[model samples]
Target: MSSSSTFPRARKPKLGYDTDQVEEFLRVARRAFDGTPAPGDPEVSAEKIRLTAFGMQKGGYSTAHVDAALERLEDAFAARERQIAARLHGDEAWLREARTTAQVVSNRLARADGERFERVNPLVLGYSVKEVDRFAERLSRYFSDGWPIGIDDVRTVTFRAQRGGYRESQVDLVLDAVVDVMLAVR
Candidate 1:
């Protein structure tokens, strides 16, 4: 009855209906039929009558087979979604690790160069953080409950930059002076 074509049976086999069930229904139907002969009346027991009608309504499809098919489809889609999500999480984890490694490398570089840190971190390689040693000092300030490093005095640069265009040598002196003062206080 479905668009799905079935192979033509050389001899129509009685596989669709359960023979035992049909026999039981026939035994019950005979008793019911004896009382009345109504037109187009199905004489089977109520349950058997419902079952037979259900069978015809489904065009001979077994409910068990249909349910199994749906379950298998659900399982496959769930597995596929999980696999994709796992791959995405793996990528995200790798990115976070890369960012942490980059920050660590930058801190080492900043310490190697004797650059003094200001309230605002003084090193920015365009968009990328080429140095991040000041982040450590900031963390220390936060964790130490503002004890040694006064929160207000973070911008304590005693000497001002020279007015008439700074030379490389003068800039280095400024940096050294700031570092010396901070280290002396510590």
Candidate 2:
């Protein structure tokens, strides 16, 4: 268990997360992150943080503050994981993996706009073809010319929805892979 001093206390409000529950969860998450052995504690992962749910209550942590903190925590965990993988696999293998993944993204991007990803159902909207294609072009340049880009850049990307656009799931999966590969190499 982490020292109480390290945990940020929640404020009381009409509606907010349950402070005690949130604090306990954070303690477990912190222990996992620090690589401390804790019986029955699940290994912490970025996805876990991303999807974490907190109970609501009258007096609790500020949602915005908690969310921002969680984002930073997730990034730190991802960076640490990347560093460990690179250390274990060696630079050559890491770079090779990155290049191969980049190639996959490039090939997918090279396809015709509407055909790049599977379309959503006729009634439902999908990602905008023009918007995704434009971003894909930038991503291609980043791969070819070593252009500077950040994981946040890819993670925060948004596309307008259109009736017959590319599949959002496919684009998002590729972007997530790109972020992982980039982080591993860096």
Q: Rate the local accuracy (lDDT) of all candidates.
A: 0.35, 0.76
TM-score of each: 0.20, 0.74
Which sections of candidate 1 miss by over 4 Å?
5-56, 91-186
Clashing residue pairs, backbone N/CA/C < 3 A, model 2: none
Which lDDT tens digits does candidate 1 get at residues 42-160?
54432233224223222333444433332333334334434454487764564454445444433433443234232222332221112223433443343334336442233222333
Put down candidate 2 lDDT per residue, 1-186, tens digits, no spaces: 443334444565356666777787788888988889489887688767755789887656677667777778878877877677679987688778878988898788778756778888878899998899888878877877877777678867899989878788898888877776776666
Segments in model 2 whose C-alpha atoms lie over 4 Å from true places: 1-25, 47-67
* Model 2 worst lDDT run, 10 consecutive residues: 1-10
Estimate candidate 1's alpha-carbon lDDT, on a 0 to 1 scale.
Answer: 0.35
Q: Which ten residues in a row are the worst by lDDT in model 1? A: 124-133
TM-score of 1: 0.20
Candidate 2 TM-score to native = 0.74
Instruction: Return model 1's CA RMSD, one decimal.
Output: 33.2
